[model samples]
Target: MMWPFDRCRINENDLFKHDWRSRSKVQVPQYIFLKWTLAFLVGLLTGLIATFINLVIENIAGYKFLAVFHFIENERYLIGLAYFTGANLILTAFAAVLCVCFAPTAAGPGIPEIKAYLNGIDIPNMFGATTLIVKIFGSIGAVAAGLDLGKEGPLVHIGSCIAALVGQGGPDNYRIKWRCLCYFNNDRDRRDIITCGASSGVCAAFRAPVGGVLFSLEEVATWWRSALLWRTFFSTAVVVVVLRAFIEICNSGKCGLFGTGGLIMFDVSDVIVTYHATDIIPVIIIGILGGFLRSLYNYFLHKVLRLYSLINQKGRMHKLLLSLTVSLFTSVCQYCLPFLAKCQPFDPSTTEACPANGWSGNFKQFNCAKGYYNDLATLLLTSNDDAVRNIFSSNTPKEFQPVSLLIFFALYCILGLFTFSIAVPSGLFLPIILIGSAYGRLLGVFMGSYTNIDHGLYAVLGAASLMAGSMRMTVSLCIIFLELTNNLLLLPITMLVLLITKTVGDSFNPSVYEIILHLKGLPFLDANPEPWMRNLTVGELAESRITSVTLCGVEKVSLIVDVLKNHSQWVPYCR
Candidate 1:
């Protein structure tokens, strides 16, 4: 048998005659330009589609929550209950139906699936057109149903689908003949496109281009080349630009959707925190605690997933009903919490109260007081994003009291764990941040009670530590948090916490993604091997029988070449 590259080898005379640059300069430039242009276009389309999905989810969730708040304000408890229950039930049911009846591959965060795919495992329909549609709408519905899930993970899957579609020369049935760009039909180009799309998804989701590139490098891409790094960076940049444009357009010229000039809006100017040497003690403690908590969380999450699988095996309808039940329970709890808590009369004119329009410049009716939401439910569930921002604010308002912080920490830890891996399109990123920040704030509050420490700083540290522990990501998480908050000053602390968290977490078990991959029985080769196995020699593990190849003479040259090409262990012996 001939080696694959044997026919392509150049002779010495041909090598001397070949021009250094003249022969391929024009063609190379055009090819490079086309490839880059295609990458940029894919990133742009991914961003546009991801942004649209985010907008739809925001609008739907906002409307549903507002409706409940409106009824609460009118003192119509039963009607609000009915609306919340009905909406969540129908939305979750519909989302589950789409996943079950249409695209079963569309369920979950999709990061593990994408990771597996990148590692050369083929999951059917993962990048198909049908999966794309179902993933987009189903994720939107799942998030809008008030489930404690995020759109970031699903966005990754969506971006990959878009990239695959374009890279595969578009669909055959499409009317546009020009849609078929056959430049990226090869395996190498397809993989590169998918990697670019994954990075673009992170970029669009977090508005952190640099972090997105690092995330792609650290988490997704199993194999990386120098050129792919540049391509991923370009893709992330294009995605951020397109996403920001859409956000500004949707917000009617506002700098950012969250009013902070970024995806996660936080006022960094309110409190400037200077870390003292003593602060390291608390930071270290938080890191250790975070690692243990993550280990515990992953264990429980797997057990819960197993339970869910058992229930799912009963029937598709049973799975759908379970989803609806979870959504209904969550909605009812969120809605009823405001009424259950004591309402303190809050004067909007007061210094400490929330603004007249409330946290996000809307949803003032949910405020138990005129402008104050002293209620635990309001603090925890009214709007998760806003609540997180408040916790991170230097001069926190009345809503983010120390007690409220503690309650939120406990509540979200439970809720986030259970809520994840449900029959919904939930991403662990946001929920992990939410829970981590709450604990960090709680620690900050405690420190503030004793010394003049900044709670916001601790909140940031806690968030970084917990996320690192849960995800088992070190550099990527650090960069992501830094980019997400634009808190460059916190880099030292963030890096330390992540390092510690990862060290502690890895000592116990693998990351959540790795755990899920193992649970699914995907053939993932973990880079980290067991320490005990290091002492074992290859001979100890090998079979007793051995085969050897010998080249008797010049007549066996082709045989030697074939053996060399086919078997890495073959030794060509000449006698």
Candidate 2:
């Protein structure tokens, strides 16, 4: 079969010059088909490999990070500190060297480079192989370091490299034997490769196949045309199936990769807030504040990056030193004030805490964690509306404390932002999400105490909203959480908050991906502009001295067929 890229269409008038049957009979060679098939198979295998890397990172590095260091206690604050410092230093140092040395295209989100590739731009030579190695090492290192970052970013590149290898067709890669060709001769299908990788990465990370394709199209390709959808859907589906199958095979067909059991099967019970109507006003107020916070984060991060650039002019080493220093300070703060570090518990006495007690069914307030998990737990346990009412009405703490949480968030954002700027091979998807979630939860506590709304729900809302705001990826962020927990009851509210937050953030700052690319001196980083001809208006083209086409009834088929076979014939009558 002729691939879409190789097929040349014919118009009605071409029938005058060529025979339809002869041209229509043209077929793709077996060898070329084999190679393309092999590419797909290789991509499938690489997808599984990429998934393996992700699983290992997620479980070992993401959750039990301190496990990397046998000396530290599992949940001790020092383990967090050591994990953040020692690991970040080494990772930062490696990233610094990699930036100057290999210069792979896997830095920051990997989305931008994929975007550029799709638009016919060239990526670095070592983009594929180097990225696969660097991202796994650096991200694992970052996770081991405890920087509040995630592995979703690296997976994008890893997925893309898998695609590239499948499509591998450089001159040096060819053999002299008779498999003679299907390779596109040119090595510029970079976008296609990267898009494949990115789509698969997002899919594997969230276990939401369609969402991944939407993300690659919306956030990476920025291509919403009809034709590209099928390929994107097909590729994402294929990769996810392979990855999931491998996961099942590894877990003995019992869904071991996503989870074992209890955590995934827990159900939420209805909550009775004393005055549900009264809470609407407060919830709305929380949403408005959440939007504002989203905007603020974008603003602060941009300013921090500017400041970091101003202070560290020496090179990657200076930048590394600066980030290390900031990380150390954050680490120290996190250790001294355990409440400040990533994913801290909400405080009820303060207006900022999430009102988790209202939903938890657990009328005993302040017992749950600070974020989403707590919110769900709260929804099931709270029984008395009066208890919920009393909890909301109780006088919050007299004083506001920003010294620790604020400092920790600031440092965390700074380190994450600069890490992207420094060209470290890493994914910004999770880091940005983590940053948004952390900031949202911290602010959520204040809103909870002041507004009497559930901080847990607010934090969950914040996590999704902030992610949507920062990355400018609302659909994927919302869908990601849905798939992660397989819960949808709160989807509507999540989408509403995400919409407001995204709009607010866009008004203030470029999406994270665009900003990173802009920092690297890239052009049109947000959208890939079409070539000049495609950009031309139909009116202008029609008005030009160009040939036209016209078509009649039965002759249409013959004309098209003739055009297909002719070398230099006109098809001006198809229209």
Candidate 3:
């Protein structure tokens, strides 16, 4: 939910300079040529190289080592525990060493680092071309090692570096001013250029331009006046264009509007426009719940950091051992649980039947049924046995009951938040939505008896609404969800839920990023704090005091003595 951007430091002295709104806009051709010539080449090279590294780490390294210690194949919990322990030990060693050597800036979410860098924090070693390699390979290693962190955070930094490196070759301030004399000339700050890369990365990841832009505006920068509004919009458009073109080249004519549609559609019949007033209550409830989830996630992360620090302070080796212990536990649980083990194999008789309880192969085809003993039930579902089929068909009504789903939703949220707080590098982006969707599915099964809404719609709507609530961006959330899924019909519902979640969430706590910055003693606060606040320096905020001294003297000796005495006291000068 953290939007991709933070705050910008505006120069107070330049406030009265030519108003940007009425200034001659940069011609599309020249400005774009500059960005494309530089930003594209840099971003492309960075992205492709990063992507390649991810492929190698994920495809090559993981398969080679993970297979030997994979006890989950035999459905043995103890063996799985050993595997998890061994894997965690190896991963922690790799992560700790690599993190110290390269990509040290990637310790936490790289968003704060990006914000700090934009505010002129000196990062002498902010690798120009090398960051691409580190971000790509490091992220791949982290994820493959099962550290549970997301790639988007590091991608933000990677993108910013690419943009900065590309823009580094651009004209300096004096040259930019001289060039401004030309009517066609336009001077874009490093912020816009960096944002172009950042947004493009977000768009590339989620394939949602509006969401990416909103993320930049909301979490990236705090201050925004009308001057920046239009410029950012134009810049976002350019970046989105770049992303779209690249995606098209990658997938070739499969994306709907942007990428894979999941929730909404653009073309809607007028008949589907019927929204009763009663929908408002449910929408509001959704928003509040979303905010609660966000708060819980943040709270858990805070606790994890605190606890991990305390444990590590005892000794560095102890911390690694603790992480290794967590890994063993997780692996043990994963192996014991039937559904977690693997999807049951498909039956020849029933096309919907899943595979065995434990399979090391692809899981994309399995039905992700929920519940504690869900694996056993799923296996039964796949079996051709008449007795198993009869038992499953009879229990279907109870299995899909609303009460059962509510419990699942609660657990899903808890697990999702926990997984993210573990401090391992994996994307939290989809996990949040996945949790929300699963919860929504459970709620849908319960609410279906009373409402006309389809369960799939509920699942998608819940994800959108919860995301909006967590992020606290209503319009942007709505537009993004609509764009991402190409589902226009759900817009009204998504908006309703977003409003509900944001209202409740905001009332309880500000954005998580603000809380983090406050805790870190960072100068800026809010998406955009006051301009003066940004200009206020640490020196200005310090308290000062003055002291006076007296001296006595006479003739030459007195004069020398007086000079020494005055110098000793550092007396004030009197002209």
Q: Which number leads on lDDT?
A: 1
lDDT value, residue 170 of candidate 3:
31
Worst 10 residues of 1 by lDDT: 1-10
Each candidate's lDDT (Cα)? 0.72, 0.51, 0.49
Clashing pairs in 1: none
When summed lDDT is taken over every stretch of 10 residues in candidate 2, the lowest stretch is 262-271
Model 2 quality (TM-score): 0.64
Candidate 2's C-alpha lDDT? Answer: 0.51
lDDT of 1 at 354: 55
lDDT of 1 by residue, 1-575 (tens): 11111111123354435632454656656667877887888788888787677666656766776677677678787997899889888888888899888888888889998887777666767888888899889988887777777778888888888888877766546623452344444566677888888888887777778888888889987767899899889988898788667656756744222333344223344446667777778888889988888878878888887888788879888878778778877787766655545554454554444533332431233645564555465454445556556566664434355665666677677677667766666678878877888888777766655444577777778888888888888888888777765657778877888999999989988899988887777766445678998898766766664476555635567776787677755333445
Using lDDT as the measure, name the better of candidate 1 and candidate 3.
1
The per-prediction tally of clashing pairs is: 0, 35, 33
Model 1's TM-score against the true structure? 0.83
Candidates ranked by TM-score: 1, 3, 2
